[model samples]
Target: MKNKLAAGLLGIFLGDFGAHKFYLGKPKTGLLYLAFCWTAIPAILGFIEGVSYLLSSEENFQAKHGRKY
Candidate 1:
């Protein structure tokens, strides 16, 4: 299972390169983010996603991601 803390950290720090997406088993989206890493959009989105992950309930995260972190 993926770890929420790890994923959140990755997203917050290396999310421009889609590290968190890869960790979450979303290679396609990860590649997309990587391809667009030159833009600031990925970083902004990643930060939001990271914070959302950290704030979300565990059950909600599990239900959405299909596994516990």
Candidate 2:
């Protein structure tokens, strides 16, 4: 299962490289983030998403991301 805390931390730290997206099993999205990282938009979005993930409950996260791939 994907860990919300881990995802959140990654987003806040390595999100510029799309680390959080990769961790969430979204390779395509991760690559997109990488592509636009130079623009700094990904970093901002990642931070927001990270906070959203941290604030979300397990059930909500699971419901949105699924239980198992």
lDDT of 1 by residue, 1-69 (tens): 567888888999999999989989899999999999999999998888998888888878777775645
Sequence-dependent TM-score of model 2: 0.91
**What range of 10 consecutive residues in model 2 has the weakest lDDT sum?**
60-69
What is the C-alpha local distance difference test score of candidate 2? 0.90
lDDT of 2 by residue, 1-69 (tens): 778999999999888889999999899999999999898899999998999999999999977775664
- Among all candidates shown, the one with the greatest lDDT: 2
> TM-score for every candidate vs. truth?
0.91, 0.91
What lDDT does candidate 2 reach at residue 24?
90
The local distance difference test score of each candidate is 0.88, 0.90
**Per-model RMSD to reference:** 2.3, 1.3
